[model samples]
Target: MNTSATLLDTLRAEVDQSLRKFLDLRRPLLADPDLAPLLQAADEFLAGGKRLRPAFCYWGWRAAGGGPDPAIVTAAASLELLQASALIHDDVMDKSDLRRGMPAAHKRFEALHERSGWHGSARRFGEGAAILLGNLLLLWSGEMWRTSGLAEEALDAAMPLHDHMRTELMCGQYLDLLEQAEGESTFEGALRVALYKSGRYSVEQPLRLGLTLAARGELPWMERLCVEYGRSVGIAFQLRDDVLGVFGDPAETGKPAGDDLREGKRTMLIARALGSATPRQAEDVRALLGDPALDEAGVARLRAIIEETGALAACEEMIKRYLDDALASLEQAPITPESRQALTGLAIAATARRT
Candidate 1:
């Protein structure tokens, strides 16, 4: 029941090892000239991360009074694979130029085609390859979970939650895509989309899955408490990301300073700013928010407007409120003291992170 920082570090190491082992076994299955790159892509993508999902899952297990189990680490690592799949697909969809400080999965594949002097459209090849790779990662996530060697009973009890997590992630992704096209999204809609896309999957379900596996059945109280904590904190996590999207240092964020603005995401910040703006101000934001050719000056203008319109202040306030709620919920939760403390630290780290 020791959920210390060291324990988190240990879990991260174990998860990384488990991921490497899985990749080693799976790589041979695709042992071919054409498919070598797929394994390489997965390996590279999996190299580094915050390991948030698995951390939540592992801590949930601990919170349920479960003892340490290596199989759990192997199974929890599946979340990382799921994350990879989502990122790859999302980058492709967004046509994002960078990921984790490197060329995006699709762009890398595209570069491969160009270097090889392959025929046909390089962009298409890159996009197609990245999509297939993402699909492979998704399948591998399930495989890792299924073969993690957690007791069959635990696996069976947890399988439904696992499936639903994936479905919810996709559901959220669709909502995000929908918001972009549907113009003038409301604050409520943006918040809803954030939860659907990343909030739940990021914190709640992973914790719930861990608890479910430990209990080997449903726990009504645990579920109820986790939902509140995850919803509040999870939404805040995305909001923090939105804040970083605009104001984070590039070196810290591993992306350009103004990528979110360039993408014109209808995030809560944008929605709030628009909601509170004068007609001229709103019109100016609309002109520069998503302009692909937006220069440094334009980004500065938008940032100033966001700050001046009180949207930046409002988003920060919302994040603080949600984070406070999440921490308070954990205080009264029926879990181990160690877990509560670990989760408290995790709450701050996830929401207050610079990257």
Candidate 2:
């Protein structure tokens, strides 16, 4: 394998090990037998992921002249916990039944309630438990970062960025809900949702956090690189995700086909489709877009509309443009040669992934 690929694999392994160790240490603190199920749910939820955020953080540190260090790995792994919290909460908000091809946290709890013959409404119990689980994971993320064993000065320097990342994530999620509530959205509106909801947190912030931690403070060029390169790559990543939401195989995406359509996500693809659609096509989309009971036929029809309207091609072109911008920014970045290459590989992987 090439150097960048090898390093990425190694970084993933290290982060996984760090997560396992951290969870094991925390296990004793949650010693109650009743908490076993919650802990197990967390474990299952966390067991799968691309670990992209942590990889970005690690490579950002390396770019800033930081060397291999277990402390950094531990710090990077904390982002995974933050990611987990987001996904768990998001699944509940969307009322999604599956995640990573397994029953979603709420569904798992709902089934548990049913099996136990609980008196309360199973759905209510499930949603409440899942929300609590998400909150717990969010809290744990902060705890893990604070205790990552990095130097006091470094940790303090990075804390503000971390705080800002979490704050932005919540705001973005709210914006997403607001967009759905408002019904159809403009292309600009959809792009705004994508930028804040997933892009900034997924790439820019993680890169900035690592750079800040390694530099012990923000450098002048760091912000520029993050904005120019990180932001572009992040947006492209989310764009690819929007495509996968409709076109990806269930086996690869771990969700039912066209789940995004069922959930009525106001993605840029949808915005573009609506923009270019005929009256009949627009009517069909509006009718079938958000129906929870959308069957394969409905999905197929919607997919055809999206394709015929050229939305899929438009989104693909946008992804390419963003990726080009990101890679161009990297070419002029005054970082390590190895990091530039690795970041290039990461950018490609993020934008080109099937899941």
Candidate 1, superposed: residue stretches over 4 Å from native: 1-3, 353-355
Taking all chains together, the TM-score of candidate 1 against the true structure is 0.97
lDDT of each: 0.88, 0.93
Deviation of model 1 at 316, angstroms: 0.9
Model 2 scores worst on lDDT over the 10 consecutive residues at 1-10
Leading candidate by lDDT: 2
What TM-score goes with each of the models?
0.97, 0.98
lDDT of 2 by residue, 223-290 (tens): 99999999999999999999999999999999999999999999998999999999999999999988
- List of clashing residue pairs for candidate 2: none
User: What's the lDDT of the predicted structure labeled candidate 2?
Assistant: 0.93
> Considering only N, C-alpha and C atoms within 3 Å, which residue pairs clash in candidate 1?
none
**lDDT per residue as tens, model 1, 12-68:** 899999999999997779898888888888899999788999989988888887788
Which sections of candidate 2 miss by over 4 Å? Answer: 353-355
Residue 207's lDDT within candidate 2 is 95
